[model samples]
Target: MVFWILISFVALAMAALLGLILLRAHSMAEPPAAYDLRVYRQQLSDVDKDLLRGVINDSDAQRVRTEVSRRILAADAQLQKQSSGSPQPKGMSRLTVVLAAALLIGGTLALYSLLGAPGYGDMGLASRIEASDNYARTRPKQAEAESKVPPQPNPNLEPGYADLVAQLRQTAGERPDDAQGQALLAQHEANLGNFIAAYQAKQNYIRIMSGDLEPQDYGELAELMIMAAGGYVSPEAEELLDDTLRLDPRNGPARYYYGLLQGQLDRPDIAFRVWVDTLRQGPKGAPWINGIEAQIEDMAFRAGIEYSPISPPGAAGAQAPALAGPNAEDLEAAQEMTAEDRQEMIRGMVARLSDRLATEGGSAPEWAQLIGALGVLGEQDRAKAIYAEAKTRFADDTEALAQLESAASMAGLEP
Candidate 1:
């Protein structure tokens, strides 16, 4: 109520000032100059007196009288015209002033009431800065919590495979300088989403390489780090991506993750460009390609651009060598076991792979492995679930679907 009263008072004062201005303009119009015959008559009489007193000759007095008579006649004519002409300040009236004043105040107050903030209070500069800082400080805590939820591999794996892993662990422990053992451990650990152990094993492998690393090694290391960080490309992972790209610019994983890092660094243009190029050159079924495609569209949207990547070729791509339930040596050992033991171990292995893929999604090859394993185990329901999930995850990915389909057909599973 008090605020409204103050506004009303100020508005009234402004309206009054506008009214005064209009009235002053109307009143300030120049009034017609007063033209009277009496002044001219007085001047003519003075000239006649001067002549009578012998101050001027007759001809000079006549000339002066003629000029005075002309002035008096002109003045009389002007006064007559003025009486017939319009009144003073003819166009501007008092009503116009009132309307103008009312309009000025009414328009301003109406606009303010319509557009201005009527109830919002100011959060001063300091408070606003504090709020912004608090927001910035809170996000990492959420990310840290997510990263700490360690990935769980299935507990019920094959006893033989578990024994093999145990043997490998023993070998790696005994021969701590064995680079090959460390590398194998890293691959197996990552395959299981034991990212913490995978990271340790990869670091050991990196140390073994002694700064002589391949782009594939760097890319794999970056992947391990990102998985350990719950998919966030931290600065350390970014550096590994950088190293991967430096070694091989065509490295698919490096290019994709580098784009992600660029997006995180708020360089959407670079991110968009890198991801687009990666899509153009990448194989249709690369595990990272779907993620890259999504990120590209998102960055393009945010950068206010229209983006459409060229479709990947439909031709069959060169696939990596197949890795099934076990290697030849492990299979030979499994063949020595009793038939029931062999069947139980095979089911256990397949179950673990299924659990791993379901819990923590894997690469295209890993997905193939899980699908094939499920088919071999004759578990059609789980195989269908895996297929459905893979299809959903790689919705638009023709190459990945093709690979899974081939594996399904070979395993003689239901479509």
Candidate 2:
């Protein structure tokens, strides 16, 4: 109520000031004809003074006096015409002032009501930060977030592949001690977009590999968990992100998700800073780069920063790395070879590519190909492991991750 009273008082004061200005202007203004009349009368007086002083001969003075008198009469007539004309009605003038005042106050209040937080008081930086912290501390947990998310539809899969996934799920569930089975189930479930099941399987895999866990392990689990919760950064996922960062401070995926967590917690200032730094430290292809680009402007606005969108370095006219795969000649050669020979040839190619990547890092497409080739050769476990490593490798590269995801899908590893 006090806030309203204060705002109303200020608005009314401004409106009254405008009205006073208008009224004063109208009251003090002199007619153009009145000024002309005064000037002509002064000229006639000067003519008479000149006649008396003999500055001019009597005949010349008389002619000048006659001209000045004619001008005075014309000026007087114009002044009389102006004065006799219908004057601005006092009521109408007052109505105009009232309308202007009403518009000034009403328009300001209406615009504020539409665009401003009516009751929200101005918050200092420290107060805002404290509020954000309190909000973060009170945010929903993983289970609660997951509960609020609507059920996602499973991806369309071929019958044979669907059956295989079903069998894998059953086998992995029955063999709780089998880490390899759990890993496979996790990969396949994720590929089928069963993120909840995928994350659960990942949990089992993490438990089994607890003694040998890497940052990427926790990062992957957090990624799946976030996906399962429809991108909400749950407390569990936040903890996983913390663990990932603790192990590898520069983990791109974990850092990106952590910034997202900050945004969700009403701390866009921190989120903006984190995302800006992350965007600048680019593999330009990082999976989170697009997300950052899409959202960072809004975050900056919320953080009270004057921000222009920054494109990732090398984003303009950037080309994908040339994929390392068989050419037409190799295809033709393979067509002529015996089935066993062809299989052997493919295996030889895969081996050479694998060795090259292991010794000297290759492009993301090459890694994706190797993963897919491994899967085709009945090496699902190796494909799954390679998929994980490839994701970690191109974590910052959105385009590379997209290519890797496509290959992973084809390899029946994960989505």
Candidate 3:
């Protein structure tokens, strides 16, 4: 929207400038002074010649010559006054010619600056223009994707989160060592309102970034782990994201995901800075920047923290501590787990959660996951009641409340 707005403004400004130039040029093209007088005198001469040849009456020729003489005298007097004028101001003396040329060139440049070049992508004018055009073309698809975003989790999941847990167990079994697959499983768990499982999977994904993985692959893994951190305020998850960024400072995905996680943590100032830095580094009109900015704005609005219009005044981004934590160590351990063991473990954990939620009802630690599963399973009323109960029951535990709220939001269940 901002990009299109800017383009419209530029187009209007260019049209206005062109109109002004045409108007000025028209004003400068006044009728010539001496030419009109000269033509009148020539006509008078022809009348006199006709009279001498007895072609016209004497009175008519005399009257025409008098008017022609009067016009000639008026033209001469005006010319003499113009020629006799005092010198122009010193600033404009020989500078008139220079100033006129300067005005023409400078006006063109000023107009171009205001309306032609958009300072985007840290690119040259031509490059910026091209990129802006390209972004414009793709923006509609991006907007539609945003608009059509699934309302939280799909509404076919069931309560006690049995279906979600089952889905994750199945997927984990299918792709035990796949970082992306595990990350997707983790995200689905998160969408199912299972923060613990999400946190576990995210930790596992982060832990596996090791000697075998390329820097780029590590960066991608870091991004998913950071993104999954939004499900829980795990100090471990935070540390992992911070560490990933430290290892790959310029990874756009890692930076964006980290920014989002920061926002989730209600660190608007930090999130804003990270997003601003991302915008500075990436190509102009980058979709990531828009997404990050939107997240930051939403976070700031929710937290009632005023986001600085200007980014944080610093060269450095979010700072991380030197030491790794237990979760990080656990991730490292998970990386060493045999694929079969990992699959069996996740399956057992999901089954345990399902059993606990079914027996213990909404008071269980895994109730939210059940609610999410229930929401997906088309138990809309049950999910809403469960979410409302969780929100009220766990009101004292901000983390629990937040998790419940997140689940409700994803489930599209009113709280």
The superposed Cα distance between candidate 1 and the true structure at residue 242, in angstroms, equals 1.0
Q: Report how far residue 298 has shifted in candidate 3, in Å.
A: 7.5
Query: On residues 1-415, what C-alpha lDDT tens digit does candidate 3 reach at each position?
Result: 4654665566556655655565455444433555565787788779878998998797877887788888888877776656433333444434554555456556765776797644643455567456645653443332243344344454443222344467656866676675544555565765565544665665565465345433343443344433343333234444545665677786666677667655544455566777778867754333455566567666667546776643432232122221112344545665666655554544444455555545754442356665654544445687787777667766776446645764564454554
- Candidate 2 accuracy as lDDT: 0.78
Q: Pick the candidate with the highest lDDT.
A: 2
Whole-model lDDT, model 3: 0.55
Flag regions of model 1 displaced more than 4 Å.
Answer: 1-147, 150-159, 313-415
- Single out the weakest 10-residue window by summed lDDT for candidate 1: 27-36
RMSD of 1: 17.9
All models: lDDT? Answer: 0.70, 0.78, 0.55
- Per residue, candidate 1 scores C-alpha lDDT tens digits across 89-198 of 53556677677768877887788779866675555656655554564344343246346766665754443555555555777789777665676667566656677677
**Cα error of candidate 1 at position 269, Å:** 2.4
Task: Report the lDDT of model 3 for residue 246.
Answer: 73
* TM-scores, each model vs. reference: 0.46, 0.73, 0.28
Candidate 2 residues 1-415, lDDT tens each?
Answer: 6667888898899988888877776666677778777888888888889888989888998898888888888878888877543345667778888999899889988988998779897677888888888877888888888898987776754323455567678777799977667776777788888888999998998898677766877898999999989999988899999999999987778888999999988888889988888887765755677788888888899888989776566452133343344667876675567656666665777787887888888778788878866865668888888889889988997768867876775455656
